[model samples]
Every structure is written in structure tokens, then in C-alpha cells.
Target: MELGTSLEKRKVPNMLKRILQYDVQLTKKFVDLALRTTTLKSLRNHAKLFEVSCHGIVWLACWLSFIWLFNNKELYQLQVNMFIALILDIVVIAVIKAFVRRRRPVPMNKLMELGPDKFSFPSGHTSRAVLVAFILICLNPISIIFYPPLLAWVTAVSISRVLQERHYLLDVVCGAGVGLLEGLFMALIWFSQSASASILSSLSDEKLDGGEYHV
Candidate 1:
């Protein structure tokens, strides 16, 4: 069983790498077409705004605001878990980018300002965006209401990473997957603790209300 599990793990990465290779070719063609077609002056100007949104400072400020707002202990824990997940995503992306050591697309000036990140196997911006969006969507009771606009923003962020030439299509795709996995991991840990606490609280309430005495 262990051998089979190990084999499956090895196969999965190999499969994903093959998919990335094909995706790169498709993305190159698509990006070429997009660049030629996107001639609108007004639209071009807005790309910088999208680029600015991807920076670390913007996310840091947003997280700080959330930390300030969620003062309740339970809510505070949730926010902290999310913050940790974002940090994990960043660290994982940094390590993977270093290991992959993939080169960025040339003519660096065409990329959005702030130059380019050192390597580009996976997009940190796309990952962080997806991580934040996924956590918010899952944690909120009114996620249905948030879904449409939130997904639009997520899609825009992913596309921007590609169009700006900061990442290939596969990088954004893989980054999104990684972000989701991290979010789910944190959610499970947080919720499990919450469930256990609720159970303990209920048990204590029963003992007190019933006036049960232990020898």
C-alpha cells in the first residue's frame, strides 16, 4: 500500500508537469493575440491599478484592517489562521519559484511596473488573491451574494498575472491550486478546534444545569 501510494504521488507531479508544458505553448499564443488586440488607450492605463493590487503592501494593509475589525476571540482566531495561510502560500511559492528557476518573459518593461519577481514557475499574486478570496467565500454566511463579484475579481487577477507577462498561464493555474489547498488545510484545523470546544461547552452546561455531582 505504501509503495502504491508513493507511486501515485510521483505520477501526479509528472502529470502536472506535462500539463504545464502544453499550457505554456497555448498561453504564449493567446498572450500574443491579446497584446495585439488590446489597443484601447483607456484600458491600458488600468492595468497599472491591477498590478498595484497584487503588491504585498496592499494585502498587508487589508489584513491589518481585518485584524482590527474582528475583535471577538473566535473571529480573531479565524483571521489569524487566514493570515498564516497567506504566509504559507507566499513561502511555498517562493521555494517553488527558486527550485523551478524558470525565466520571465523578455522585454521586462512590458510587464507591469515594480519590475519582475525573481522567478516565475508559480505566480505569488494569483496564489495570494485566490487564497484570500477562497477563505472569505467559505467563512462568510452570505457567500452566495459575494460569489459573482468575488469570482470576477479572482479571474481578473489571474488573467492580469498572465497578461502582464509576470507569469505563464500554468503558473497562475498551479498557484491557485496551491492557495486553495492551503486555505482548506487552515479551515479544517480551525473548525475542528471550534467543534471540540463547542462539544466541551455543551457537556459542561449539561452537568451544571442537571446539578450532577461527581464523587
Candidate 2:
């Protein structure tokens, strides 16, 4: 019985190792196929456009600047919550990437590499895309007519990560899941207009005029 127990414990680790190896091999095969197929290659090239659109730094900077400059009462709640959510997304992605330390499918140029950017287990762009889409759609930030485009953007961003050989299939999949969870978490702890205003007030010298704002 003791020998059987020992063998079972050893087999568990071997099983996990095999699963990880299979994942890597499968991702390599898919990336190679994408490179060889003309249609896929073109799609990958186009997908690069979407990748640039969802860059984390750009989104954060734009949102932060908007929050500081515009300060429109109509968009106060969304702007604040979204800005905070973006920060939350960045922190979560950075923590996970640091913990996983998974290498990208291709080595990034040293000049472009940033902290946590070298890891590939979860695509930061994918997560950010998903989080933004979820907020825009579920939160009804804009007219419902924009839902389709928002969803399409998220889908494109997620697929582009894999097609561009920036991440494994599992990485994109897990990223979407993470983004969805972050959206739900933000919803649960959603800041009220007053809460958002107070937080923003503390950060900036801006004072809200005596007016009611609705989300």
C-alpha cells in the first residue's frame, strides 16, 4: 500500500508536466500553421492594428488625462470607475505575470521590453480589451448601438494575441476569463458617484459644483 501511494504521488507531478509540455507543443504548432497560411498571415498583420489600439499604457494615459481635463458631470462616474478599473487591471495583470513568469512565444526586442511585459501566460491586451468591452456594454456607458463594435473589438484583440504569436491559446483564453472576473469584481465594488467624486477630489484639486450626477 505504501509503495502504491508513493507511485501515485509521483505520477501526479508527471501528469502535470506532460500537460504543460503538450500545451507548449500545441501552441508552437498553431503558430507555425498561422505563419505558413497566407490568409492567416494577412489576418495577423491586420490584427496588429487592434493590438496597438488596446495597448495598456495608451489606454491608461488617455483615460487619466480625460478624467483630469474633461471632468464632465455626465461621465463622472464612468470616468472615475473606469480609470480605477484600469489601474486594478494593470495591478492584477502585473502580479499574475510576475508570478507565472511565462515567456512569450517569441522573444521581445530588449528595447521594447518593460516590467511584466516579457511574460506571456496571460495577455494584458486581451484582459484590458475584455475589461473595457464588459464595462462599456454591461455598464451601458454609451448607446446600445455600440455594443456590437465593442464586442468585435474585444474578440479581435483576443484572437490577435494568438495569431500574432504573442501568446499561447491558453494565455488568451485565461486572459478573457480574468478580464470577465475583473469586470464582475468592479461591478460588485462599484463606486457610487459620491464615492468616485471624493476619491477624485483627493487626487486632484478639482471640486464638484453643487449638482446631482446620475450614472
Residue by residue across 72-137, what tens digits does model 2's lDDT show?
Answer: 666778988898889999999999998777778762324432344678978889899999988887
- What is the TM-score of candidate 1? 0.68
- Name the lDDT value of residue 40 in candidate 2: 73
Lowest summed lDDT across 10 adjacent residues in model 2 is found at 107-116
What TM-score does each of the candidates earn? 0.68, 0.80
lDDT of 1 by residue, 1-215 (tens): 99999667555476777876787787777677776675422333455677677666677778767665444444544556666676788788888988777666553355445464668777788888888787777853344877888787777777877776677888888888887887777676654436533543454543323334556
Off by over 4 Å in 2: 1-12, 36-39, 107-116, 207-215
Pairs of residues clashing in candidate 1: none
